[model samples]
Target: MHDPGSSEHNNRIPKPLGEAFLSLLERDQRRMLRICTRLESIADGLPGSGKLRRTAREIAFLDRAFDRHMFIHEKFLFPLVRSLCDSRESVEPMLCQLEAEHATDQGLILEITAAYAGAIGSTPRAVGVPLCTLGYLLRAFFENFRRHAAWEKMLLHPVVKDQFISETPKHQHDAVLRYSIGAGRSGRWFPAVVG
Candidate 1:
């Protein structure tokens, strides 16, 4: 068994499948950051900037991307972590907490979508509560999401890296397919290459 805290384990690269999983997650997060920056600018210029339509569109995109990202975590990453770590007692709490956060995020997204759905026209007053709520909601989601992603990366990556370090390439590929395709049931969304 690999000692997760050992310096050697910390320095080792994750096995190919684990590395690929982390890379996909990191890519999604970077994309999210770009969208968050864009949303922040829109929020800064809110209320009467005639960006209502654009805000709606951006929020929609964020909603979809965020939903998919969270699905990958809840369905794939968390379970994989649970199976990989010998000390489930150490990791289970974090997974549960993150899952709760995912629920909260979904609720927030619904509220945001509802707010923007009713919002119409370019005037500040016409936009009403949505105009008032939009900036705060966007900030809340983006801030929480950024923190959550960073926390997950910090806590989980080391375990994944250490656990897979000694796994053979064939074993790695089979494991990836087992978790990411057969069990995750999300192969359509993110197809795993058998090779």
Candidate 2:
């Protein structure tokens, strides 16, 4: 029942990264939830036979989405924040923690992918392994992303606005361009229908 493009679901625009990445994350998260829900439904329907191909395809798609999500956060968003945020004391540790989380995220995605593929080629009991792996990964992603977004909104954005006034004018303008380019190139993260 989640609407990926619904404005109500979109996160408020953080001045650092702009609203575009937040919108993209909202849309992508909804799409991922939809895919996971559909996969669960499909799995539920095939109780005994174990539809390997369908499960494999779903897992593959999820893997691709996770990859793009990580890339955007690590490569584009994090670097921008690091460059702009003047407080080395607070920002540095947070960025380090965020990077560590990203690594964990990648690990979880890889584990899910491997387990899902292995399950597809193995016995029925093995199917549960991937499902559980995906469930954990999804939960972790939701928790981490929500926390990260909140931190940016409440703490980071305000600091940037108040203390780092010098960057404000250029920040907003750059944020729009960066986000537009990032979103446009995120065709890999988006579903074919959205693309």
Question: In model 1, which regions exceed 4 Å deviation?
Answer: 1-15, 121-127, 177-195
How accurate locally, in lDDT, is each candidate? 0.71, 0.55
The TM-score measured for candidate 2 stands at 0.54
Residues 116-178, candidate 2: write the lDDT tens digits. 555465655455464555455545545555565566457555554443344454656664454
Cα lDDT tens digits for candidate 1, 57-134? 888898898888887777677777655555669988888888888888788788777666545544454455566677
Most accurate candidate by lDDT: 1
Clashing pairs in 2: none
lDDT accuracy of residue 39 in candidate 1? 75
TM-score of each: 0.73, 0.54
lDDT of 2 at 38: 56
Regions of model 2 farther than 4 Å from truth: 1-17, 29-52, 122-171, 174-195
